[model samples]
Target: MIANLLTIAGTDPTGGAGIQADLKTFSALGTYGMSVVTGLVAQNTRGVREIHPVPAAFVAAQLDAVFDDVRVDAVKIGMLGTPDVTRAVAGVLAARRPPYVVLDPVMVAKSGDRLLAADAVRELREVLLPLVDLVTPNLPEAADLLGVPEAVDEDGMREQLADLVRLGPAVLLKGGHLTGPECPDLLAMDATGEPVRLTAPRIPTRNTHGTGCTLSSAIAALRPQRSGWPDAVADAKRYLSGALAAADRLNVGSGHGPVHHFSDWW
Candidate 1:
């Protein structure tokens, strides 16, 4: 069956991040993409200037409309900007029980804009983590979730992954920011005998505007149809690496340009 994937996130008019990137990833991977916008962000490759969160009830309404009509093979959740929105999502997912769910705890932007509210962190931890199949967080986001100042090295990443997996669902700790010639991501889960390490040579590019969204969405799109989480993650990494390598082809915004979603097409 063709996978019909959904992304619950904010909007980005620049087509670089948020819902835009998620949808692009799903399509690029041969999945039908659907979306429910939780917030509208005024942003570009340079930075996020402002964000107007959708009302909690309206967010719920969007979820209802989508879930009521479609068979969502997998779901990817990004920037839930408020506590109420987070609760709404958790409740809805609990009711529908989609085949797979990938949560990207998008706390901050590449340009350093705070995408998640400080207070909403508690709600996300309490309500959403248990429901997700996997939680993909970068080093900084893993640190924030674990209440640590930072997760700097391989040891730190493993420690954070162990702590996070206890909250339920597998954890994918992205090491993109860790200093090295290669970027290694750790996938930790009880089902797996040991933590699986995924590594890729660092792609040198300033146009990596929507890497997180792309990676999470790619995994979500692959999960149901792919063999297993580890395999899905590895495939997602390959896709993201290709997109990053081809980013220069798309002459996007002046600052950090977006990874070329349709890189394979051209």
Candidate 2:
């Protein structure tokens, strides 16, 4: 059986994030993964050194090729490096309208290095935000995406996440980076919906490279084989928390390092 999932994101040479991490997550979770590369990134777990975005035409073409041939049950979008790439991605998502779409709003790396330009943030919100089913933004990324100054715990993270909900799609405000030993990954839906908070003990490790991409992709892989949004988020949280716990034992880079996706994966 071909359990196909598509990852439309940038390329990560370190195999820690972007398309590389998404594909690894899909495979680990028993989905045969296909990818549409939007940008070419040069980096390790430490940080992104360079980014060369694929041409807009080529980016759209890649998606066209995949859609024309593959049976994609789910799709994950990440790291569209430029406004052009973002527009291209939005177009593909609108056209294909896959059953499950997970959007990881990858603006900056966990190391605080810039993966996207300041101006491209507007393009993402205007073009891609409404096209996907769900958007997973880490604390900082969520803040940036929502025009909020910062995602400070002292400044009320829940309200910030609630504001992010107005951006159209369901928002999962990942609280892993919140200042605490225990982290809660929050799911804030549209208005009138009860927010679901899935909390997990923060893993004691520094190898958290590519966590957002991995989490969203894992959820995409599970959705076709599982239930709906909240269920998918729960499954993704379980898989990622396990990956984080095994992260320090992984040996992929001299920097933050990659997750050990093969162990205890969904």
Candidate 3:
């Protein structure tokens, strides 16, 4: 059966990130996509100007509406603006227990705007991390979650990965933030004997607005079709790279633009 993937995230009217990006990714990978909006963001590729959060109760209602009708094969959770919203999402996931859950710890936007609130970090780490199959965090987000300095090198990345795994989810520690020609992502889980390392040549591009959202959502879309996380992650990485490599082909906004979701087709 084709996978039904749900993205619980905020909105990006520019179609570069959040719910729009997630749905596009799901479709690009040949999966059915659904969404629950957590915040209404008024912005574009340039920057986020204003954010209007959805109430916690309504967030729960939206989740229920999806779970009640569809058989969700996997879920990709992005920006939850506040702690209460985080708890609401966690509560529903705890009750529903979807087969696969991927958390992209979306703390800051590519434009450097903060998407998640400061206090919400605690709730996400304490309540949400444990329930997910995998938690994908960039260097800064990993540091924020662990309450430590951002990893500057491979050693720091490994050190933080160890600390994060104890928090109760397999971690896909992205090394894109590190200043290097090549970007490496580490996937470490308790059951998986050794951590798998996947590296790609860093594609130089200013159009990387929703790279995180795209990668995580792509993993969720492919997980049900693939046998395991490693394969899904590897394939997702390839997709993101292609999207990044082809990003310049599209004319979007002025600032950091979005990667092409349909890079392979159009």
For candidate 1, lDDT tens digit of each residue in 136-158?
99999988887887888999888
**TM-score for predicted model 2 compared with the true structure:** 0.95
Which lDDT tens digits does candidate 2 get at residues 142-209? 87887767666724677887777887889888887777888887787685587888888888888888
TM-score of each: 0.98, 0.95, 0.98
Comparing 1 and 2 on lDDT, the stronger one: 1
Looking at model 3, residue 255 earns an lDDT score of 93
Model 2, position 238, has a per-residue lDDT of: 90
lDDT of 1 at 176: 97
lDDT ranking, high to low: 3, 1, 2
Clashes of each: 0, 0, 0
- Report the lDDT tens digits of candidate 3 across residue range 155-236: 8898888889989988999999988899998899764356788999899999999999999999999999999999999999
Please give the lDDT score for candidate 1. Answer: 0.93
- Cα deviation of 168, candidate 1, in Å: 0.8
